[model samples]
Target: MEDFLVNINGTLLKGPEAKISVFDRGFLYGDSVYEATRTFNKRPFRIDQHIDRLFLSAEKISLEPTYSKEVILSEVLKTIEAAPFKDATIRIVLTRGTNSDLGLDPALSGPNNLVVFTKEIKPNPAWWITDGVSMIFFQKKIEASGSLPKTGNYQENILANREATSRGAYDSFMINTHGHVTEGTTSNAWVIKNNILFTPPLADGVLDGLTRKALLEMAKRQMLPLPLVEKSLTKDDFLSADECFITSTTRNVVPVTKIESHLIGNGKPGALTLKLLELYLEFVK
Candidate 1:
């Protein structure tokens, strides 16, 4: 078994041997949609939801997938099985495919290419959840589209993340043009105040993250101590909140101890945030 496996359009290859054409629109113009999901004890978590979102993302960008959902899921499982890892992070990418003419028109592109890469999952630092991580507000406004797909075009996010890291922060929190806190570079933002949780609604141009969805569902089922509210939040609201946290597939629920210079809830992981993380892990199990 290999350390990692890459399955390109049904043909599996070693990680180092896997390659795609330079003419592929995904590489040339960043015309592609992708989903990243991780396994819990070798079993994929919420794989169906991930596949559903992947197709939706492709549809939003008008990029038709050559293979059906069943086929994609099958390939993901097959690749995971071929890899030697107790747990893995799976990334499924669907590119607009190759174009010999080097044109921007979708009609010029050939069949879409599907690529699945499965590799060992790298656990986050313990202090990230124990002591908590810090974040900085990204100056640039998020993309205006609320229904934006998880496409290959991530230059904005990449730059924001870079700026945050350079500034000694864990991640960058992005605000939309309306001054509403949308989300982090690759995670959904949440704030708790007076025991009530608040997060920017999908209307605020935030991605419909699966982890965020799971948290919301937990709140709906009364599993959380605080009632979750989907509302637009500004920087002021976040800075003054009693607790703050970010969620993603790989990171799960991690507390944010500070944003820029302002300390969040005593400059440590809040009790509610820890509880939420505990609940999330139980939910995952």
Candidate 2:
């Protein structure tokens, strides 16, 4: 693909040149909060919402932003303007700075903020939506005392996704120790049956995704009944699902056709998923 420019700590660098220090806790300890947003028609989409989520994530993780929201937005726009591709994904990350040689200082300096660094995320393929995709359950269980959802503590997801890929799957469903399907590696999971929408609750340890929240709001505005059943899901629950889909900032909404070896209803994108995707695109536009 084409190269892009990235602005980090007030410096503009090419995609390959953009780099962060290894000493940064975000790198060393995975102690950081991040948000991802995409562009539509070459313009940043829902930028304000994305920035709000970034700040919210930082707050949830007890990490303070090094710059104000306005400044961060300005920097992101600057980076986008410098990129080669007009339409692309933008990522904002904030990390805990180094603790220094003195070691373990709770009173350490404020967070080290890092801006854009040239990232791109294409939408799912046409077939992925029209035909839908299959999902496999990972062997690992979500941790009880997990890091804040905002933080980049995705070690469990990394492993699970790797396992899923090896198993010839499109996505991995992470089950909590209590047997609840929390979420996917990088997307929020949803299942529909008999016209009722069901997704794991935050109590199940799923990230409060912005896309998920927006879709839920849209459904409410349109007088759609969303009975959010935050209960555990079994393999049978997926097989019995009339429709299933995943949501994220980049993917928006993609259909899930199968769970493990069991095929969802008709092995085609469900009507509910199709409606959600159409509504979501209209909402975005």
Candidate 3:
């Protein structure tokens, strides 16, 4: 319900005042990477892992931030302190800075730009967690190389998600070129079959998500006979699933009540899905 602070190169500015150049490669060529996390009770959850992944993304794109990890974390904490929400979504971005010429080369002549900001997050709708959500399938364009993961080139996901929501779904279940089920537009997908949890592996061109790792760890701590496994998946795998769910920093473990025309597990949230949500609530607390 309030404006939050923004951190650009260590300077704290009002969210609206923080600005970057149009010539910045992030604007020019989509040469940027970002990480996001949501807070619980004003405390950002597993932000370190998010920052670590941000670094990994930078490395993948050959971006070397002049700021150290500690400095960036400190700036993020400052912005969180300025946010007035019980729950906030914090995002950090690194971009190739402005240069004399517009080019795709990484050897630009400007200092890399960093942006950190927090926004008030509304409470997740109870129905989203209880009754669950629906999704449609999005096939890749076939011409796009599409191997980029965790980068800022989100036009495809934006378009697919817009189309899916317009068609009465919350998001789209994306399919890679190999006909493998990859993930949701903004989440990592998982399914339960015969009481075992299954998800796509990183080799299937999915983002290595932090919440997914936490869930796997939580599963390991389960003495309740729950098993978690990662493997390649397809539309058939999801359509035949006993239960389906997705994980992200913001939407932790949201059950999938349906996928396209197929009703997942009687068109209701599954028992294991609810249990995992409880586990996640406790884990975050």
Q: Against the true structure, whose TM-score is highest? A: 1
Of candidates 3 and 1, the better by TM-score: 1
Q: List clashing residue pairs in candidate 2.
A: none
Q: What are the Cα lDDT values of the candidates?
A: 0.90, 0.76, 0.83
Q: Lowest-lDDT window of 10 residues in candidate 2?
A: 101-110
Residue 37 of model 3: what lDDT? 90
Per-residue C-alpha lDDT of model 2 across residues 9-95, encoded as one tens digit per residue: 778887677777766777667788787788775688888888887888778777777788898888888877776665688877777
Candidate no. 3 TM-score: 0.93
- Cα-lDDT of candidate 3: 0.83
Candidate 3 clashing pairs, residues 3+ apart or interchain:
none
| Candidate 3 residue lDDT tens string, 165-215 | 999999998888889888888899999999899989887777888888888
lDDT of 1 by residue, 57-149 (tens): 999999988889999999999988887876889899999899878889998889989999988998889898779999999866545747557
Q: What is the TM-score of each predicted model, taking all chains together?
A: 0.97, 0.89, 0.93
Better of 1 and 2 by lDDT: 1
The best candidate in terms of lDDT: 1
Q: In what order do the candidates fall by lDDT, top score first? A: 1, 3, 2
